[model samples]
Target chain A: MKLDEFHLERIQSQWENIVDYNLSESGVEPLRLNELVPHNRLQREILETKLGYPQTNGSIPLRRNVSSLYEGATEDHVLVTNGGSEANMVSIWNMLHESDDRDEVVVELPNYMQIWGYSRAFGANVKSFWLTEGDGAWLPDIEGLKDMVSKKTNLIALCNPNNPTGATMKEEHLKAIAEIAEDCGAWILSDEIYRGAELVEQRTPTMWDYYDRVLVTSGLSKAYGLPGLRIGWIACKDEDKVRDLWSYSDYTSIAPSMLGDRLGQMALEPAMREFIEKRTKRILKENWAAMEKWLGENEDIMTCIPPEAAPVCLVKYSESIKSTELAESLIQEKSVLVAPGDHFLLPQTIRIGYGHDKKKLVKGLSLTADFLRGEE
Target chain B: MKLDEFHLERIQSQWENIVDYNLSESGVEPLRLNELVPHNRLQREILETKLGYPQTNGSIPLRRNVSSLYEGATEDHVLVTNGGSEANMVSIWNMLHESDDRDEVVVELPNYMQIWGYSRAFGANVKSFWLTEGDGAWLPDIEGLKDMVSKKTNLIALCNPNNPTGATMKEEHLKAIAEIAEDCGAWILSDEIYRGAELVEQRTPTMWDYYDRVLVTSGLSKAYGLPGLRIGWIACKDEDKVRDLWSYSDYTSIAPSMLGDRLGQMALEPAMREFIEKRTKRILKENWAAMEKWLGENEDIMTCIPPEAAPVCLVKYSESIKSTELAESLIQEKSVLVAPGDHFLLPQTIRIGYGHDKKKLVKGLSLTADFLRGEE
Candidate 1:
C-alpha cells in the first residue's frame, strides 16, 4: 500500500539534532538506569539472561502488570507491542478494513498526526472530528463527535490526555463518545500514551473503563520516561481482539524487543512505577510553571490555556504568521525547535514541550519571542 | 486490513513452552551476556545510560558498520529494522503499492510462511515458485522462478540460506534470479538472515552484491546469536528505497530499541563479529554432526540433506504420518518439539534445528526416533 509522507516524523528528523533549544518532543526527559534501578531491578539479572526473541505475545508477568492497570482485564487481554506507535498501527490496521469503502473512522484533529494519518492513508473513510476551545479549555465537540459516528463507522480514534493540546476528556464526555460507538456498533481505539502525565490528583479516565469495545493503547514512553525501551501494549477485555492483534503483531514487528521487554517488566513493578510517577509529577510541575510564567510575560504575543493534564499544552500565536514558518525561523535562526501546528492541522499554534530540560525550555521560549519580534 | 491468522506463530505459541526439547527455532544457541561481554563490549556501559529512542534511521555507527559488510554501499543505504521480520514487512509494504490488481509477487515455496503470507495478505497476486528436491537435495526450480517473474511482477521475495530447507543459492543462480527481476523492472527482496551462518569456507553470496535493486536483509539473530537484541537491517544500494523504508519505519515500530541499537552497534564491531562467527561455527559444526548421526540412525523412516549454510534443515518423513501430528505426539509424550512443515505448505516434513544445546539436541533426536519407531 502506498502511503503519504509522515509529516511530524519528517519535521522532527530535520530539527531534533540540528537545533539546540528543541521543544518538539512530547515526553519528559528519559529516565537514567540509576533512577529506575534502586538496586533490586532487572538491570543485572535481565542483562545476563539469554536474550532470545521475547515471548511472541509478551512476558506473562509484564502483561499481567499492564492488565492490572485497567479494570476487568487480564494478561489474556493484553498483547505487548514494539511501542505505542505499533499499538496504534496494529489497532487501525487490524480493525479497520477498507471493504467496499463504506467504513468510516472518526478522528480528532489538531492532534497527533499518526492516528488520523494512518486511518486516512490506508483507505479508511476518515471524518475529522474537531476539538475546539470551549469555556477556556480544549474539549472535543460532543455533538460533532456524535454526528460523525454512524452505522458505517468502523472505529473512533482518540489520544488522551491528547497529544499537542494536552486536553483531558471528562468522564461524561467519554461516556457520551462510548454511547455513540455502542449505538453504531463501532470500535473505540483510544491511544492513552500520555495517560499517566496528569497534573490533577484525579487521573484521566481510561477509555476502556467506559467502553466495552475499547482497545486502549499506551506505553512507558510518556510518564515513565522509558521511550528508549520501546515498550507499549494494547489492552482490551475481548479475547478475540487480543488474538487478532497477535496475528497483526506477527506481521508487523513480531514482538517487542527482548531487552526492552525485560526493562519494561521491571519498569512496571509497583515500586518502580510509583517512584517514576512521583518523579514525573515533580518534573511536570516544575517545567509547566516555567512555561506558564514565560507565556504570562509574553501575553501580548502568545496565548495558552494551562493544561489540566499532560506535560504540554498548545500555544497559539498571531494568525499573520504560519506556525511552520515560525517554527522554522525558531530552529534555523535561533537554534530553538518547536512543533509547527500546521502538521497537527492547526495553522497558528506551536506545541510547546516543557517536559524536557527546564533550561532548554526557557531558552526555546525566549528565542520564539525574539523570532516573533523579528517577524513583526 | 483484516488479516488471516499467522498459522506458524499460532502453532509455535501453543507448543514452545510445553515442549522440553525444542528443535523448532532457526538460530544457533542464544548468547548469554557473559559470552558477549569480554570486558570490552557494551554489556556494562549501555546498561548505565538513559535508554531512550535510538536514531530513527538507525544509529549512524551501526549503519556504517552494516554498510562495511556490503561492497560499494555506504551507511546512507542502510535502514535498521526491529528484526529480519520487520525488514521483510517494510520492504514489501513500502515497495509494493497495490496500484492495480495485476501487480504480482513471486515467492519461494517450502519457506518461511511470513515471506509469502505477507505478500498475499497485503493484496498482491502471489505466485508460489517451488523449490524441489532433486538429486537428494533441495533445489529451486530456476526455470519455474523465471516464468513467475514478468513485466507485471512487483516483488520477487526470497530468503537466502533459505528457512526450513536451509538451501543456499549458488552465485550463478542468484545472478540469474536478479537478471529476471532486472529484466522485468521488479524489485528483489532477499531475506539473507542466515548469510553469516554458512557451514562451508565460501560464504553465501549476498543478493545486493549482484542486484542493484535488491534489498538484502540480515541481522544478529542468526550468526551473531543475538535474537534477543532484536537488531536487523535492510541493505540496498538504492538510496530512494532506503529513504522510502525510513518513512514506513515511522508508521511501524518507529525505531529499534535504544538498548538494542547500542548492542547492535557493538555486535557489528569487526572483532566482536569475528569472535561470534568463530564461536557460532564451532557450535554449528559440533551440533550438525549430531543431527546427521541421528538422521543416519533413523534412515529407513526419515530422509535428509546436509545444510550448506543455516543450522536447520527440513526433513521429509514417511507419508503415512502427518508432521504436525508427529510433532504434537513427540512434544506431548517426550516433551520434544520440532516445526511442522504443514505451515510451510508442505506435509510429511519437519524443520529440524541443530543449533541448540548439544545435550538437548541429542536427547530430542532420540525421543523423535522412539516416536518414529512406535509409529511403525
Candidate 2:
C-alpha cells in the first residue's frame, strides 16, 4: 500500500542523531563492539569474513540460539529480518488473508505504531485492546481484549513487554489471550522485542508456547542493545510459512547484511549470550534505580508507571502542560530528548528511557524536572 | 498481494550451498574483505567503530560517491537500501498512484522478476516492452517501447547492463525511453546495479542523466562484487521524493546494517574506492575473455546475446531440452548451477555468470558444453 508519512520515525529521527540523552529511543543505549565480542576474537573475525548475501533465513547458529528462546522450535521455523520492524512486517504480510467481512486485526493500544499502521495498511479492520495504568502497574484490560476477539478476528497482535508503557504480560494473561484466539481459530502474533529487559527476575510467557498458530518476533535492537546490528527473527512458525515469508523478503530487504548476520550470531553464541544479556540487565538495574530515586523526590511534579521490563517507562506530569510542548522545550532549550505522551497520543506523559547511562538519565530527568517545576 | 513461492530462490536454495560451479548467480564472485579493503588499516576501523545505527539516508561519503555516478545529483537525492532488491522495491513503492485505468508498470522483457513481481504485488498492472537479440546485440526494441507507453503509464522500469541479457542501454536509447515517459508524464526507474561491469570499456548512461522523474538504483553488490555488504542506493532528481521513500524505509528494512554502511563508506572512500572497482573489473575482464573463447569453440551447441556490460550473459542452447530440466541436470549430475531460462520464462536458454573466477568460468562452460553435446 502507498503510505504517506511515518510520524513516529520522523519524530525519532529528530533526536536519533542530535541528543545526548536520547530517551526517545525504544532500546537501551547501544553497547560497544567490545561489549558483545572479545576484542581479539570475534571482533577481528567480524571484519575478516567474506561479506556476501547471507542465507535467506539466517545462520544456523543464530537461529538455533533463537530457538532456545522457545520450546519445540527449529531453524526451519525462523526468518531473520532487518530488525523487529521487518519481522513485524513479514509476519502480517504472510498471515493476512483479507476479505471484506472478516477483517478484524486486534492489537493493544498506545502500542508500537508499526502494528496498527501495518495491519491497516495490509487491508485489515483494526480494533484495540488497551492497557490501564494503576498503582504503578500498567496492566492489559482483559475484558476489553475479550470483547475485541471474535469470529471476525483475523489476527491478534501483542507486544510484551510493551513499548511506551513498558507493560509485561504474564503467563496467565498470555494463556487467556491465546484461548480467546483459539476459540475463533484466529492467529496470534506476539512482538516480544523487550522480553529480556524485565526489571525483576519474572519471565514473560512467549507466544511460541501460548498458541499453535503464533508468530513471535524479537531482535538484537532492544534487550541485546544492538539496534545497529539490524538483526531480528520470527519464530514458532511453520516451515512453509517461513519459506513464504522469504518470498516477500525478495521484494523487501532480500536478506540482512552478512556483517550483521555475523554480529547477531556472535551475540547469540552460547558462550557469550548470557554475558550480553547480563550487561543490559546491569544497565537497566542501575538506571531504573537511579530514575526511581529521582522520581521519588520529584513526586510533586511527576509520577511513572514504573516499567517492570524493557528499557523505558512512561512518566505522568502533574502540571497541566501538554506533553508535546514539554518534550519540544526539553529538546529545544535543554538539548534533551524525551518522547512526548502526545507522540503516542497520551497528552499528559512523556516516555523516558531508563536504560541509558545513569548520569545521562538523571541529568535528563533533572533538566526535565527543572522545566516542569518552573512551569508550576 | 499474496504470493505463494519464489521459484528461482527455491531452486537456488537447493544448489546455492552444494554446487561448486554457481553460474546461476547475478553478480560477480563476491569479493573477500582483503580485496575490498586494505587488510591492514580500514579493516581495523570497521571492527573498532561503535556500530551505532547509520544515518537514515546513508553515510555522507557513500551518498557522495553515488551522486558522482549521476550528472547533477547530490547526497540528498539518494536513499541507501539493503541491496539492489530493496533498491528496486522502494523505487516502485514511492512512484505508483493506483487506479485501474491508469496503473500500467512498463518493464523490458528478459528482466529481473522483482520489477514486475513487486509491481503486480503492489496493485499495479505490469506491461512488457520486448527486447531482441540480433547481430550480437541485445537491443531494447525501440519501436516496441514506443507502442508500450501511453498516458496511463505510471512507471517504466529498466535494468541497464541488464540482468540475464546483460544488455546495456546507451545514452541515445535511454533518452528515447525518457522521452516516451516524458510524453506520458510517467516516472522511470533504472536499475543500474551493473554500471561498472562493462566488458568492453563501454558505459551505461544512468537514468538520473536522462529523466526528471527517474530513480536509479545501484549498489556494491553487482558491479563491485561486494554482494555480502548488501548496500545499494536510489538516486532521483527530487529531494522530497528521497525523503518520502525514506518514510517507507521505516516499514521496509528500516536501514542497512551499520557494518554494511561503514564498509560501504569505506568501499566508496576516496582512498580505496577505485581499488575495489578495479578488482571487480579485473575479474570481469579475465573471466569474460575465457567465456568468449569457450563459446567460440562450442557455437554448434549454443549462442549468446553477447552482453556488453554486467558480469552474466544468457546462452541460448540450440538443443530442444527445457531450460529447467537442463539446469536441473547440470546441477544434479555435473554439480554445476546455471540459471534456467524458464526461471525468467524463456525455455531454450540458460544464463551463465562470466564474472566468476576465470578457471571456474572456463570449467563451467566446458562442462555445460560437454553435457549439451552429449544430449545431442
Candidate 3:
C-alpha cells in the first residue's frame, strides 16, 4: 500500500489558489451555473432535485448521453465516476485484479501522472514509453511501446490530447498501439478528457474504434469546461467489464453527486453539448493567439512545439535552474503558478495553462518572460 | 490489487432504485434543492457559482464548518472528501501506507463493510470483534477488543451509532477501546456518519475526545440527509496527517464538487445545521412510532433490540430461511428492499430503514408482516 506522491497534483493542490495567476489548470475558464442552465424550465427541474443518492454507476439519461459521444455504444457500456481520475483508477485497479499473472502495466509518458502513481501503489510493475517532439508535432514512440509490451502487461495506459504537451495521437498511431496491445492481450485505457478542445476543426479521434478491449475515459472537466460538476465516465465495449468496474467504484466513492448527474445530462444534450464545445474552442482559439505571440516574443529564451489540443502546452526553456526551482521562483518572485516540468518527469520545461481570462494570461506570461530574462 | 465485492452496497445499488418500497437506504427522506436553498440571496450565490474546481482539500469555509462539529479542532484538522465512503477509503489507505511493519487491522462488526473489504484488498491482515445483544441493548465487547490487539495492529476501525444495528457506543466503551488501541500504538478510524440521527435527545458522543490518533469520518450523507451533495470529511488532531490524507485524495477523486463545497458551507451554517438536525429527529421520531407498532404486531414471528440512533434497526427473524434468501423473497414477492444480515456478516436478520413517506412505511411493514405470517 506504499504510495509515491503524485507530484503533479500535489503541487497544484498546494499552489494553484495561492498564486496570482494560476497557469496550472488544464481546462478552459469554467461556465457559471446560470450559463449552463439558461432556460427556466430546466432550472426548475434542477432546483426541485432531491438531495438523494443518484444511481451508483450513473442515471440512465446521463449514461445515455455519455454513450452517445462514442460510436454504437449504449448506457450499458458506460460507468460514470467522480472524474476522469477515478475512471482511470477503477479501470487500472480492475485490470490488475482480473488477472493473476498480468502484473505489468505499460504507460505513455509526458502525461498526467495519476495512473502511474496509482498502478505502482497497487503493486503493478510499471513500464513507460514517451512522446517526443519531432516533425512539428509531438509524436508517439510506437516502436518503444512495441518493445515494452509482453504477456505480463495487463494494461497499456494512455492520455490523448496529452497533458502538458497537448499531443493527440493519430488514428493510425492508435491502431498501431491497439495492435501491440492485442498481441500481448492487454487492455487499452485511453484517456480522452481533452479530445474535444482541439485547436483545429476536426475532433480528435477516440481509441474506441481501434480496439475491442479499449476503455476510454473522458469527462466534462476539460472539453466541456465543467470541472465543478466532477462528472466523468468510462466506456468499454464489454458490458460485463463495465459492470465489474462499477462494483469497484462502490469502494472509492459510492456515487456521483446528484446535481452532477442532472447537470451533466443537460450539458451533454445535443444542443447544450454543441454550445459547450463551441465555447471551449472559442476560448482556446482566442487564448492560443496570445500564447503564440508570447512564445514568439520569448523565442530567444524558450521554445515550444505548438499543442494540438487542450488548454496547456509544454514550453522548453534554456536555463540552468531546475524545473522545480524555476516554478518556485515564479511563485515567490512573480506570483505566477506554472506546472513544474519536474513533476511531469520532464525537467528543463514547464507546462502553461492559457485558458482563463486572456488579459491575465498575457500579463502572467509577460511576468514569467521578464523573470526568465532576470528583469525587474 | 484483488478486491472482494462489497455485497452490501452491490445489492442495494442493484435493487434500491427498482424496488416498490426501498427500505435499503440508511438515511431519511432527502430534502429538495429548494428546501435546502430557500432564501433568494443564497440561491443567487448558488446560481452564480462557476463550474470550476473548488479548493482541493475543501473550501476553508466548508472545513471551518466541519471542524465546528468537533471540540478544539480547526480547518487545519479537516480533509473533505466525496462521501463518508471515500473518507474511509483514504484513511485506511493512508494507515496501511504509513508503516511497513504494521499490517494488522481490527474491525467492529456487524457493521458497514467498506473498510473491512478495502483494508483486506490493500493487503492488511484483518481481524474482527463484535457487538452482541445484551441487557436490551447492543453492547461492544471491550474485552474481546483487548484480546485482539497487539504490537502489529496499525488501526482499529469502528462505526458509532453503528450501521445495521443502529447501536450507539457509550463514552466508557469508546474510552476502553481507545485504551486498547493505545496499548498497541494503533490509530482509530471511527465512522461517525450516523452520529447525529439519535432517537433519544442526547447526540451520540464522538470518539474524538477519547483518542488522540483517531480519524473521525462523518458527512451530510446519513445524519443530514444530503447524500446527493456527496460531501464528507475527516477530522484528526494532527494537521500534517490531515494534509497527508489530502495528498492521497489527489489520486482518488481530486476534489469534492464545487457546488458541494459552497452549498455544504450553507448547510453547515449554525442556523441551517440546527434546522436540518431537527428535521432528521422529527422524521426519526415519527417513523420510529410506526416501526415500533409494526414490531409489536409481529412479535410472534420477529423481534428487535430498539435502535438508539440512525434510521435503521436490525430485526431478528424466527424464519428458517437464510438472510439473503429472505431478502430475495421480499424483493421478488413484495417488491421491498431491506438489507439482508448476510451482507453485514450476521445471519437470521434483516435491516429495515423506516425513514421515508409514512404511508409507504406502514404499507411496506404490513406486507412484510403478512409474508412472515403466511397470511397473504
Model 3 residue B27 CA deviation (Å) reads 0.5
TM-score of chain A of each: 0.96, 0.95, 0.99
Please, what are the lDDT tens digits per residue for candidate 2 over residues A149-169? 889888889888988887888
Off by over 4 Å in 1: A40-42, A98-102, B40-43, B98-102
lDDT of 1 at B326: 80
C-alpha positional error of residue B165 in candidate 2 after TM-score superposition, expressed in Å: 0.9
Candidate 3: CAPRI quality band: medium
Which scores greater on TM-score, model 1 or model 3? Answer: 3
Q: After superposition, how far is residue B193 of candidate 2 from its true place, in Å?
A: 0.7
lDDT of 1 by residue, B337-365 (tens): 89888888889889988898999999988
Candidate order by lDDT, decreasing, is 3, 1, 2
Weakest 10 consecutive residues of candidate 1 chain A by summed lDDT: A94-103
lDDT score, candidate 2, position A172: 82
**Per-candidate count of clashing residue pairs (backbone under 3 Å):** 2, 2, 0
Candidate 3's C-alpha runs over 4 A off are none
> Which is the winner by lDDT between candidate 1 and candidate 2?
1
